[model samples]
Target: MMITKEQRSLYRSEGYMILPGVIPPAMLAMLREECSYYLGYYDCIMDSRGVQTENISHRGKRYFINNRYRLSSRLWQFIFSDLMAEVARATVGDEAWLMHEQWVVKGAEQGMKFAWHQDSGYVKWYNPTTQHKPYVTCWCTLDEVSEENGTVYLLPHSRGGTKSEIITHIKEDGTNDLIGYTGSDPGDPVVVPAGSIVAFDSFVFHRSGPNLTGNMRRIYLPQYSEKPLTRPDGKPWAMATPFLKDGKNIYNHAEDSAENWGPFPEDKNVVV
Candidate 1:
């Protein structure tokens, strides 16, 4: 669906917008089922959904699988869909490339939040070719979510005007990664139904709480942007992969640009 004027305004002003039910049930179902491989393959315990526990394997999170869209066909279907391209067009204005993706499952536990931070700080290595600045992220809920279920809290229009600096290593920094920026506003917890989308500007400050509810909170994140002028020193997405380039699904057509680079090593659980 095309973006409305209100949606654009909200994104520009609030640094985020929740688009309800933008993903159809069929697509959501497929994406959810694909998660089983993660739950089953990892040393996960059995639950109502057939997967129970998970220890932090990668991505600096206690429970998350990173970059599945780089290889998974099913995941790619959701990312490269016409619907995704449409959203990218509206969000980034015509020439957007989906440079990254990840699946996060916040289990019921203490201090399980994704933490509050800006994506632009993480992309400080990226040299943007456009004037739009930092990239954008589309977070799709795979399960019914609530503040009690660890949904992210977003500070409205929080791109700039803050006293914060990017921390280099989140894991090594102890709880410093969770520290708030000077003059930063406390965020509102975002509650969206399953299959809903929460898209945010790159510089928006957002974080979630620990899961108090006895359920797994699942979210699939897709990051959209133009090709990076330069890749991060060691992080991936330093170059363009073009999941959606120029508001089109380039993944389904000819070879996508990778700037002759291959998959980099997994990022140590140093989250943004």
Candidate 2:
């Protein structure tokens, strides 16, 4: 199994766990290639729009590219692989849905910092009435991360808040980031090698610092809900592509589309 029993216990108590260098070499290589392609793709799209900043993305500084899994030839391999399935069954549940996936990149020397907030804060902000259990954020790292290069810092349930509750968040003016916790806690910095996956609960308060090094810091994050998360109006909050049912992968690549997975949410502001 990818996750150990001790790690599972820690996740249950602390709301997060780190798997050190567990991703296979081949899979890691492919993810790096895909991330490079998507970074350029994001740049092209931003260039076409004639803007340096689009929502949370700054042209040469930082990016939060969300939900373009179908466009890649190999992303699905990692997203739906045995490694992810084990993670899903361990954290989310036996049944899981692909809630969101993104390439969060920090440009060399100028990557901006992300605010401290829970993943569920975005859900509560957009769809206030939708009640769902805490999901899992599999933060798959493509590069060795440190505090100097924008590594994520997680506030445990004990310090930040309860994992079962979603705290209200305020939208920051300039970066469009949602701030949930404004405490003095420095948070636990995650320093790990490439191919490590830091699995955290949706309600965990997490943030990252700016990249100071001359090399880019890249992270491919795939978030999974125990079940499909829907808005109060009955529309899906994000992609609900089936991944695990009864502890097994049920994703059919050929049949995957908007029609089958349900239409993606219309409001771009809801993209977190």
Candidate 3:
């Protein structure tokens, strides 16, 4: 199995696990290439709009490019691969859906720090009444990450509180980041190789430091849910593309439809 018993135990209790350098070298290369392409695409879009900042993104500093997997010729290979299936089965369940995907990047010395908040905090902010099981975030690293390069810090359930529920987050004024944890405990820093995947529960509290090094820190984050997550109105909050059913991959490239993926929730406070 991809995840060991000890690793699974840690995840069950702490809500996060680091699978060190698990991605194949060739697959990692492909993900990095796709990330570069998408980063350029985001810049081009920003240039066309004649704006330095879009939503939470600040030009040349930080970026959150989301849900553009259809544009990449090879991204589906990783998204629907055996590696991801194993991860989904481990963290989510036998049935899984692609809830969201994004390239979260921090550029060189200007990369800003991300605030501490659960992944579910964003969902709760958008749809307060909606309830769903905790999903899994496969934080696939495209570069070796450390505290110096904006690596994520995770707060375990024991320290951060219960993992079964979402905490209401307060929006920070300037950056539009949502804050959930304000206590003194410094979360556990993740320092791992380029191809590692840090899988965490959606309810886990996490944050990152600013990039202090002279190189960009890149991470391709793909989230999966036990089932399609919906708003109180019953509309999908994000992409709910089917990946696995009954412990088997049911994704069909030919049948994929961006139209059916549903509209990404409109968050005026944050950019897509």
Candidate 4:
């Protein structure tokens, strides 16, 4: 799985590019089946009528994260595998590190909607110039996702996805409305086929619409950092996180596997 020059160019120019069939079908199928294992422990909030419910999600569509690393090691195997890391490194640079690995599940007919935002803002603990300036997040689809099923809607080839791009409420659960995107209109919906991989910069303005289709959209998200995991103030990271440091899985420490970990500093009140 080499990241072609064209792919690299597309990414740099558009801030994102979908690599069609980048993942082998067999691997994709296996991951799709295995995705259930990651979400098995958590239950979505439901109404008395047995219908899914959510405060922000209209009909209860939501994504769950496997923070405990309790699933089969195969998941980690595929994530940390050299083949995948190479793709990330192609864009983020040789020193690219896998900063995070998790499965994102959008259940069938669950109307899940992700607000428009950027990973840069979430990990603002790291200064822009000192830390990894530009990062890439690879989103591998385990299921065929289309506009009908709420594929991602994003703005491409722009200096978007930053705090400045968002002009609406800037709270923990802020709508994160883009500079010009009104409630009635967002961006364009992207159709992602199964086994496809979408790599986008952390600053790309992107969000997915509500899934109204009758199938789940399961995506494996692997975040890549171009440099050593360190905060703006010279504090180390990932060493205390559950990420793959330099392509090696380090899940042996208690603090490394702790839950409820966030990116903001202790004194910051940006969000939980």
Candidate 5:
């Protein structure tokens, strides 16, 4: 769990950072009590009542995956939970891999918002300085995040800036509407507390809103790469399609489970 050299120069000149408690309160109390027992019996983590099923979660939030190599494997111990692949092998170096996993639920009141964009425009298909220029993601939180409860509003470095730049749009009675973007603004309600951990740059530029504090923020997203990278249209960025495997259909991150097993430890006794 050591990624320091000024946090790898703030993850290569400010794309993201917030490490905080690199996760250990008994593995965050067993993944926050298995995410409150699956957000109370299959609300599928967070569907509050917007009912939509095939579960990959964006609005209904429920995307855990860990196919085989099991053991209460909720997305395989939180995407191979070894202190987030030891900070993704020190900011994406030692052949980092994982590939995908996301949980983001927001309940307290739940209004569902997210729309700013840039998770490599939905998991970049390829090309950005020769094959997805160093992917990296980690959100963590799992509760205690805030902006009155709908935290995470980022923009950090906006990965090489300018996909046209300028974006704000919050409407639906939350009004913000600015629209446009390429980079700049990676901040706002970056609260992050309950076991913090942010680490971004999948082309940054985030978004999120609507919770109005009652309790319930949950976060867990994960995505790491370097495993023989290739994209920029060369293919093999790892989603060869099977509708993108893992807990079957919906929100592909190579279907979670630390992208098919490779990062768990905080539980079977601390030994690295």
Candidate 6:
């Protein structure tokens, strides 16, 4: 989990870095299988075919709360395992806290497009200021991603830049909302074989395209933040859904500090 100096630069300038083969293949396979199982559960519970049918959006499909204990117990350790956390700490510095987990699955025929927007936009529903420190999103690829399979596309440094200032908000229609950015170029779509990990700034503008590959494209995105960087309104970090409480220790060590986490200037040389 040692990060190269180049990673630091890319994270600082582009707001993202792709670390391939960071997670083992076995764990990744299990994650995919378990996710599929959960999707079935979610579809069963939230299926919109009834009188008050649920209109689950492709982008909102991550809301399905599959069994947390089964999933978190194992994946949580894999995430905070010394190696993984070290990389996270280096880029984000100390005060990082486990934020939340999102399972993004797009079925071939039902796959949908996510409009380009900053992660912070959705985050603003609770936090509104730009003064807080940046948060990190560790997106783990469960299936091979490609142009046909709807790989994620990043807009370089879109977080701090004024170009393409699209924000995520709720429209009057009561649906997920999106704004457009006119001044930015689309960063290349990152295609990774299963087991690769991509870390990016929570503020970076990113979105996924349609899946024409005739298969499901699945990804596990877990967000984390350094301590003291509260939401804009000054709420605690635990307000985000799926957050664990202090000392609960439901999974992993469940506690971290600046000593165990901080920026590493040495490993930045390795190119992702």
Quantify all predictions' global Cα lDDT against the true fold. 0.63, 0.87, 0.87, 0.59, 0.54, 0.58
- Candidate 6: stretches off by over 4 Å: 48-56, 59-72, 129-131, 158-177, 180-184, 228-272
Tens digits of per-residue lDDT for model 1, 60-106: 23455665454455776788788878777767767776666777776
Give model 5's TM-score versus the native structure. Answer: 0.29
Candidate 1: misplaced stretches above 4 Å? 42-61, 109-111, 125-132, 158-184, 232-239, 244-246, 253-261, 268-272
Cα distance off (Å), candidate 1, residue 41: 3.7
| Residue 163 shift from truth in candidate 5, angstroms | 15
Q: Distance (Å) between predicted and true CA of 259, model 5?
A: 41
CA displacement after TM-score superposition, residue 158 of candidate 1 (Å): 5.6
- Window of ten residues with lowest summed lDDT in model 5: 263-272
Angstrom error at residue 102, model 2: 0.5
lDDT by residue (165-236, candidate 2, tens digit) is 999889999998889989999999999999999999988999999999999999998999988888886767
What residue pairs clash in candidate 3, if any at all? none
Candidate 2 local accuracy as lDDT?
0.87
Pick the winner on lDDT between candidates 2 and 4: 2
Cα error of candidate 1 at position 241, Å: 1.7
Q: In model 5, what is the error at residue 230, expressed in angstroms?
A: 44
* Candidate 3 lDDT score at position 267: 35
Model 4 misplaced regions, further than 4 Å:
44-60, 125-132, 159-169, 172-185, 231-272
TM-scores, all candidates, are 0.77, 0.95, 0.95, 0.71, 0.29, 0.74
**What does candidate 1 score on TM?**
0.77
